[model samples]
Target chain A: MSSPKVEIIESYCKGCSICVEFCPTDVFEMDGFLAKVVRPEACTKCMQCELRCPDFAVKVH
Target chain B: MAFDYEQYLRPGKLPHIWCPGCGHGIVMKGLIRAMDTCGLEKNNTAIVSGIGCASRLPGYVDFNTLHTAHGRAAAFATGIKMAKPEMDVLVVGGDGDGVAIGGNHFIHACRRNIDMTYVLLNNYIYGMTGGQFSPCTPVGAKASTTPYGNPDPTFDIAKLAIGAGATFVARTTAFHATQIDKLIAAGLRHKGMAIIEVLDDCPTAYGRRNKFRSVIDMMKRLKEIAVPIKAAAHMTPEQLEGKVLTGILHQEERPEYCEQYQQVIASAQGD
Candidate 1:
């Protein structure tokens, strides 16, 4: 009964905003040119971040 | 990650080159999941691809991958299967790469009914070399090459594969993530040739030209248009128009080419 863990690989992030735009739960935010999982608690583990990230930057556990 | 994508992907190859919101990543994820579910040994699997955005997939995977020439992935994969029939061979290519320049090789591969799985990503245009019209490009759709609108007919890839004699054929879209994984696993397990056509979204190249507002818009459109094969039977032709039928379209048992060829070789040697 715990929230899904979301991790963002900074080096791989191109800050394309795909994860921010696609996540139905609004779990990510852009920090400059990189994406950060601001609301890990909101993570639904729907895999939108991981699947839509062309850079292979996001991982939702 | 809990999925262990690292085990299947080349971690050093992180930060892939696909455009933001491109559907190729979704397809890759589905393929990885399929591989995991099938319990395929990485070292024993051979991945082959022709030139295009989808073709770049093999470069990121950790298997025995060959980034072959444009439109020749199937031909190269055939050689790998012939050399070592024990190895699981998977061919990946885009619509333009697989059906346009490589159309001849594709049909022949299906006709041969070899033991291999082919994952064809149809984004409806030539994405890598600019938004050009491709064989799968929809009629009346606009592309860079087709300034006004595309006039050529589009190919129903699944029907073509079934007609060409592939033992297993299926279709799915990037929006249907879980279904993509299931279909890919089914394709891999099939004895003869299995062709899985994935309707992916090329947001930058195909979406913009086609008047799609964003990646989400394209994904929603795919969701709206996809109809399950079983459900399609109950729907009218009007309801079916513009709707892509997902799930296994055709499948049958048949003799695989490599095994037949080996038998021929043994008989000739005895003679």
Candidate 2:
């Protein structure tokens, strides 16, 4: 079964790319410098991306 | 250079930035071991820290480390958990940072019962930025700021957590390194807020002011004063004066912040 999904709200994404770089699995991809959850199912719900994001724009739910 | 914990430790940096024989490194090592035992992927873990010597831990650990502002590890950890919720969050800080300035955050985190582990390194005094007195420096201890001996009483962090609604609370010392790992691993396994206070030796500050000749002497002092909470529970007044309690002080199962948050949105959506 797939792991927990991390829904990334694109408009809220500031695109610092910290989350993209932090996730162990390539769950996130950059779309014009904004973070896109290309593989939400790949998200392990570790929250490393959310925690490290300085903007607080991204919400995993 | 070999494949041991000491091997992973930065030798060039060592002799450690902490004062000679300070217990912070021992506590850090125990934390690493606990992480190893949990089968946590190093690259997947998030370690957060705040200002203070003990808070400098995130930089030393080879993970997704966050070295944040003073006394804000819990606040930061909250954001981390709320956002991802699946990732394990470990907050590391000292008494002054975690309990005093960050005390409010600590209480709120406990009340909310967030799914995270907080390791509080209590060496009594603010050993890093100078021997200043803190909320847990104990009443009557001398510090650079409290030359006449401290007039303010100390706080028992584990007791405070129990009172504030933390689902789990435990106390241990750096000297009990293996037990420290077990406690940390247990906290990681817990579903809600788990506060582990690790008593440490600040030989340069709390020790010197309190009159210990060396770090070993300071450990001896902790040995004499520390009574396992279990043992203390059965001790008579004759055996329990001026004793520290080292064991799980409280534990309870409760709904954690993440699951409750998901419920909130689910209820709102009626889905």
Candidate 3:
């Protein structure tokens, strides 16, 4: 399997910082008011950012 | 392949009306995943809700949905289940709509042991109506209606369901996102009434008044207070103080209401 790819749908992100705060591996960072996938390589594919995100803005593939 | 949430979401319903960091959306996602896990057909499933922020959930899902009058989700779902016994019925609503205004209906439905899954999102305050202190709000928590402090005792929703005779009762927080789907899936598979109370967060309504600085703080609080049922058993009463137990709290087998009603009809017809 290849490394996981993390994406953030900017339109749906409400900038709650939930993904940034809860990611076990520091996979996301806040860019102004939105979440950005700053370190996709560190993603363990736990899906925490995708599942806990209230806005459904994060996706891991 | 990554799970496709769009397959269950209604078209053009994206950007839901919930507030920023609202936990309702997460609960909706869990419901969708549970339906998928149970292989529920959209045409054969019916989702119903009453008037509240959490009540708006049925509107976004692709299943047969009903947005009913305030505090009447259970009543409406009961009618639907009776009329179409084969259809899978699900009810979604908030603490106020489920335990306060709809308390009578809620308990009666449990007493009937009707075959339906009720996902009650307890956000403590009435978020849609501007942060009124609801029946589930903590006694000392502040809300718009309780400027000084909330004086009302909180309702333990899972206990109420179990006491009223629901066949299955479970409690989980929105922070436990993965467990939500598992519990809801279990409820869907159960043969009689199932109540799943999700401890949700309302950053805008409940948090601001309660001195939670941000949505993250509220989410962290949920994480802090929740202790899984298995872990709680090993802890002392003092250690478990102010902590809420999560996981399936109750389960039992009971004759479903619809099947009993059918027997009554057969007897009346002299069959």
How would you encode candidate 2's per-residue C-alpha lDDT over B1-271 as one tens digit per residue? 1114543443344334566557786688778778888977766678899899899877766777898988888999999989988888999999999988888988998899999999999999888888999999888889999999899978888889999999999998876766888999999999999999999888778887787776667666766887887778789997887887887888999999899999999999998
Candidate whose TM-score is highest? 3
Clashing pairs in 2: A45-B86, A45-B87, A46-B87, A47-B84
Q: Give per-residue lDDT, candidate 3, residue B205.
A: 92
Give Cα distance to truth, residue B41, candidate 1, Å.
Answer: 1.4
True contacts kept of each: 0.47, 0.00, 0.71
Tens digits of per-residue lDDT for model 3, B132-206: 999999999999999999888889999899999999999999999999999999999999999999999999999
lDDT against the true structure, per candidate, is 0.91, 0.80, 0.94
Where is the poorest 10-residue window by lDDT in model 2 chain B? B1-10
* TM-scores for every candidate against the unseen true structure: 0.94, 0.78, 0.98
Best by lDDT: 3
Number of clashes in every candidate structure? 0, 4, 0
DockQ for the candidates, in order: 0.51, 0.01, 0.74
Poorest lDDT segment (10 consecutive residues) of candidate 1 chain B: B1-10
* Model 1 per-residue lDDT tens digits across residues B47-70: 999999999999999999999999
* Model 2 regions more than 4 Å off: A1-61, B1-3, B6-15
**In terms of TM-score, how similar is model 2 to the real structure?**
0.78
Clashes of 2: 4
Model 2 alpha-carbon miss at residue B162, Å: 0.6
Q: Each prediction's Cα RMSD?
A: 1.8, 16.5, 1.0
Candidates 2 and 3, the one with greater TM-score: 3
